[model samples]
Target: MQFRNELDFAQDLDQNDPLRVYREQFHFPKVGGKQVIYFTGNSLGLQPKISKDYVDEIMKDWRELAVEGHFYAEKPWWDYHERLAAPLAKVVGAKTSEVSVMNTLTVNLHLLMVSFYRPDNKRFKILCEEKAFPSDQYMLKSQLRHHGLDPEHALIEVRKREGEHFWRTQDVIDKILEAGDELALVLIGGVNYYNGQVFDMEAITKAGKSVGAAVGWDLAHAVGNISLSLHDWGADFAAWCSYKYMNSGPGNASGIFVHEDHLGKKDIQRFEGWWGTEKASRFMMKPEFEPISNADAWQISNPPVLALAPYLASLKLFEEVGMPALIEKRKKIVAYLEFILGEVAETVSGSFEVITPEERGCQLSVLLHGQGRPLFDYLMKNGVIVDWREPNVIRLAPAPFYCSYEDMYQFGQILKEGILKLSTVDSLG
Candidate 1:
């Protein structure tokens, strides 16, 4: 697509967008009586306008039904979590039973590791991307420490070559093989948070499987942003938070995807709870755990109905629009965003470059070589909402569900102006 630099082109695209109405479903943050141009959906998505209604429904059930709400409410609390299975399954591309809403991301990661990350004298190392989300970094380190292994000795990070912003698939495959006898597990971000690069998860899983290593992904950035088929790709297990592209809410419940092949295996250990017990036996008061033969087997507690309500509200939208349609819209928006950024780069004398590759989702991590906080602050003050990573990168993710092509064009204009203003300020200083 030859993207035009004119505002009319963006406006036309917005008018033609099939999903343009989706923007109205969300509550955009207002600054000075106008909605800010939001591009941080990769960090925290905007609140769905229907979120309050969903939460209120749960609250009403609690008020009137009390304990009876567990079984008697309109959407019974007893089965509140089960309702999420089909929608979450569609989002992650798995059999309904293979997916479940559970604890937050890191907690689920640790739970999954209990079964997948079994280190031995021959296989004791974990391979993950360099500079993974800090929570993942700390989680892996702590997991290794819990097993009496040194982080330096047991963790293998696949790094881009010097000067590169992202890792190549072959490089990761090479590292997986290089670790060979010492590799017990391979975990990577499905879409890296810093560079916005979507890894070749299918190929990465295959390579890890070839080396007798279990493969998993932290899909915090990938879920609901790009197409996924964790079950088909043969990912051993995966976890993701719903607050970002999923747009559930801040710090909402995360999801788990455990491939069916991994389920029904008695050897796989998980921290146990009543929530995972088979429904028929759950209320029997029997002692021995009869686990559900699916991802719910990993649940440590009954579903948090309140926390799950907001995500359930958003998942209804996911079920309606589906990932295929969302992904199609994403491709167009990303192309327009790339084109706008390219145009901005050409007009600016300041050092500006986009580090995200074409194999990315909504995010474009711009490298502000000589200009950083000053430029970012200017954009924010001017009603542009994006995020800044330390050292010199700014991440702008125009989410397809709510972000319009006009938003990209306007953000580009803001970038163009911000750079020029900062360059002048620096010259005067």
Candidate 2:
């Protein structure tokens, strides 16, 4: 489809968009007393208006029912997190029994490692992408250290080609094979945060498993933003936070997926707690720790219904639109955004190079050569909300759910103005 930089063209696209109604569902931030064009859904999603109703229901239940709310309130607090299992499973392409909501992302990853990352003398090294999200790097390093292994020898990072912006799938597969008997685990962010590149998880998982290694994904940016088939991919485990594309409030609960093969295994090691015991026997005060028959076995505490409320509210939107429809709009809208960027670059004095590869989801990481923080400040002052990385890069994520084609066009205009104005100031000085 041919995309034009004209406002009418963008508006016409929005007019026919099936998901356009969703834009009204969110509350956007105001700058200079007007709504800013939001482009940071990769970092934090806009809050859903209905999220308040979900939170208020929980609050009202507490006010009216008190302790009895655990079992008697509408949507009982005892099993409120269970309500999310089916819908959340559908979003990530896993069986309902394989998915559960629990602690934050890093916490869940640490817990999952207890079950999946068992290193021994023969196979002790872990393979991960170079410059992983800092939390993940710390988690992996600390876990290795706890096992009495040196990070320099136990961690194998698959570095990108010297001049490239993304990792090649074959390079990751080759590293897994090269590690061979020494490889104990393969964990990586499904979508790279810095470059916005979507790794080929299926191929990499297959390669990892073939090498006798446990495979998992940190889907912080991938979940709700890209299509995933964790169960079919044979991933041992996966975890993601809900605050990004999932649109739960800041630092909310996380979702986990564990393969069916490992669900009821008695030999599997985990950091068990009361909530992980069988539901019927939980109140019986039994002495033995009989694990739940599914992914909920990973839970270390009672589900936080208050934090899960907004997440369930957001999942309702995913259930209504479905991923296929969302992906369809995502492809067209992102293509249009790329076209607008190219058009703007041709007109502006500054060079804008998009580092995000074709295998991306919503984000486009732009390398703004000869531009700096002043240009970013100019965009923020003028009502364009985007993410600025260190040095000279801006990350723009046009989420298919709430972001519109007009927002893309408007961002292009704002970005062009910033580049030209900054260039002029530099020249005059």
In lDDT terms, which candidate is top? 2
Across residues 1-429, which tens digit of lDDT does each residue of candidate 1 receive?
788988899899999999999899999998778899999999999999898999999899899989999999999997799999999998888999899998899999999999899988889999999999999999999999999999998999998999988889999999998998789999999999999999999999999999899999999999999989999999999999999999999999999999999886666778899888888898897888888888898997989999999999999898889888899999988888888888888887457888998789888898988788888888889999989999889998989899999898888888888888888989999
Instruction: Tell me the whole-model lDDT of each prediction, alpha carbons only.
Output: 0.91, 0.93
Worst 10 residues of 2 by lDDT: 345-354
* TM-score of model 1 vs. true structure: 0.98
lDDT of 2 at 96: 96
> Pairs clashing in candidate 2?
none
lDDT tens digits by residue: candidate 2, 311-424 = 999999999999989889988888999999999988974577899999999999988887678888999899988899877888989999999999999988988888888889
Give me the candidate number with maximum TM-score.
2
Q: In angstroms, what RMSD does candidate 1 have relative to the true structure?
A: 1.0
Worst 10 residues of 1 by lDDT: 262-271
Q: After superposition, how far is residue 1 of candidate 2 from its true place, in Å?
A: 0.5
